[model samples]
Target: MGLRQDLRRGIRLVKDVMRNRKAQGKLAEALAAQPPLEPHHYRVGVYFADGKVNLYQMRQWYKPLAELSKRHPVLVLSRASGAALAMLRESPLPVAYVRRVVDLERVIHEQDLHVVFYVNQNAKNFQMMRYGRRWHVFINHGESDKMYMTTNQFKAYDYALIAGDAARARLEKVLWDYDFDKRAIPIGRPQADHYSGTLPYTPDERTVVLYAPTWEGDRGAAAYGSIASHGVALVTALLATGRHRVVYRPHPRSGVVDHEYGVANRAIIDAIAAVNAADPGARHVYDDGPELGWQLSAADVAIVDISAMVYDRLAAGKPLLITRPANPAAVIDTSGYLGACEWLNAAPDPATGADAGASMLARVSEVAEDPEARARLGYWVERYFGDTTPGATTARFHDAIDHLMAEWERFAALHADDEEVDDHDEEGEADEDELG
Candidate 1:
């Protein structure tokens, strides 16, 4: 058994190496075909080091970054070949493939990068943060109440563009002696302003339900995934109801840590396919596409776990249900919106022996029609995102960037006479292979 496992691992490793090499070739060819980026053209830089697997982190920002580029030219400095290749094909903004430390330095030297944005807390982000004179800002992928939202890693950046009052309050409770007024800027959810993606199905009388669950976490504390516990049952119940259309968008990293979780996720997807086959007009979608906005906006009700999806749906200010984690060990932070939000449990009813799906249907119906629930949701929306008025968040986002740009100029003039220092030491540089 050990021998077989080792052989399988070796084969998988070989396949990964071959795939990466192919992607790198494609990236090189693509770059060679395009016009070389002009020197000092971009003022704003988005540094992403994660590969294709985590592209969702970057995909959500496409529209906002494209819009931001209109005023201040934006560039994406991709550190992974696969990510660079993918972004080069689809990203609205120009992409610079900086796979090695030396390549990264070249982009830094060329671009007048006044503000650099980070989407996630990828360890490789530190590689980009080491440079001085530019604002290393953390504009995270999404807004959420997960423990990840309050990590001490926030202190590492020059500033964090947070969501709103709730995020500030949440950070204050945990991060000690942090200068919130100076370091944290609330721009609301700028992505919310530009919710892209067209509707896959036409408008109908059927209630649309978007069930976007997070991945099975790497640890028990973060085990908020409901795909294994609540997903199959709830999705099944919704499909059985001819009046409902289920839009299942599971996290991109779903089931990476657990086999059973992957099985359940597949089951939900298969059920959607089968239901659609049986009724072509049902239009129950199993969306794994890069676009995210339409599902959030079109769905009559959304069911999400304890991850960023909860906050993403909340930003829509629509009626939604938060799936209660089946894992008792799963940590729940109720200090913010979770404390007062509606919850959907996986437990079955003793009287009816009904599964999670049946209960979910009832909950979905209740939330969809409840005026009181809508009112409550409205309050939380304002608390987390400030003004959901169209273009409001986008304006705030641009304002924040303008503020940082002005500050950069102020500091630049203050130390104009100081000797220029080269922070990129040869000893500190990692090998090209080490970057991946």
Candidate 2:
């Protein structure tokens, strides 16, 4: 959902270059910081994303990544707009924007960067493995915290930062476990700031259900079914039943055209109007409004697919259902979507009609109405989102990151090519307005 594959704007590439230029301008900030690699002073180029599987998890994980890397002379490889960057500006790592991939390669030559770490996923990343000038490291973001969708170069990565023990070892499976000295560096995700916060719905207990799906049509992979329409139908039926209030939030990347679902199916306004015509009480929720706390706190039940919201919902220890069966290909995506993590729960198909849904709603309703179901979902939630003691978990994560920044700093002392960088950035300058 982060970067729409077919979107016309090469916005990200341009944003990345601008970040680099901004970093180049702040050389003074590094006066007290250690120098870079050799006569070239090769600085490690670190890039992060709004690229996590879900925007929520991306924000969830990146917050700490930024917090821990504050003292280093790291440059950010971002294509995020200034406004967009501001949201993430909390990051201490310097940013270096690149307008285009070809230009980015030219800038890499100019800046003499020796290493690149992407918290974001990229197809071009595989190129870094074949390259001789730099090294590439990958850190994928997710709720289950497993290493499911790693690239082909995963084993070649100098390091792979993960979140949970299960999350980290998933990577070790591919790269040789126990070879941490050479294969992987299990510095868990710094993005997880807190699983604690105010609840979205405490006193007000209307039956609430969250509907979130993923964006997949760019390559035509999303056209397999009519989940959007089916989802709309389900909402209408729920409203008619007058039994629950629905919070319908389509995937942000749903802007892509679907001949089957149609553009109208993608619009929440229509879905909202449809609900109002029916129950007249449903409310719309979003990233800005619900936040993670509210969504986890408010909902009586959550309905989702491979989207990371399931992870958040589980954190609430509330009733949950995986929405599937709308797309004809639902069975396949549900079975293998991204692998291990997706396997965490059961996905009920909405297309099985009201009978199937009623069955699920019954199960979720039990979880909502009965303490036993609530406790069971709670156990599953902990298995998914809960971790060790908060204090110790936070301490281990923060210290590990602080140590990373310090290690990065130590590496800078041995590098020497400053003038070489100025020459390299010339081609990498960004062209678009950056996201704050």
- Candidate 2's displacement at residue 337, Å, is 13
Model 1 spans with C-alpha error above 4 angstroms: 1-11, 427-430, 433-436
CA lDDT, every model vs. true structure: 0.89, 0.48
Reference-based TM-score of each model? 0.96, 0.62
Roughly what TM-score does model 2 have, to 2 decimal places? 0.62
Give, for candidate 1, the lowest lDDT window spanning 10 residues: 427-436
lDDT of 1 at 265: 93
Predicted candidate 2 versus true structure: per-residue lDDT over 276-331, tens digit per residue: 66643444333333234455555667666555555556555566666543435442
Candidate 1: residue 6 Cα off by (Å) = 6.1
User: What is the C-alpha lDDT profile of model 1 across 85-195, one tens digit per residue?
Assistant: 899999999999887788889889988999999999988898889899999999999898888999999999999999999999999988998999999999999888776
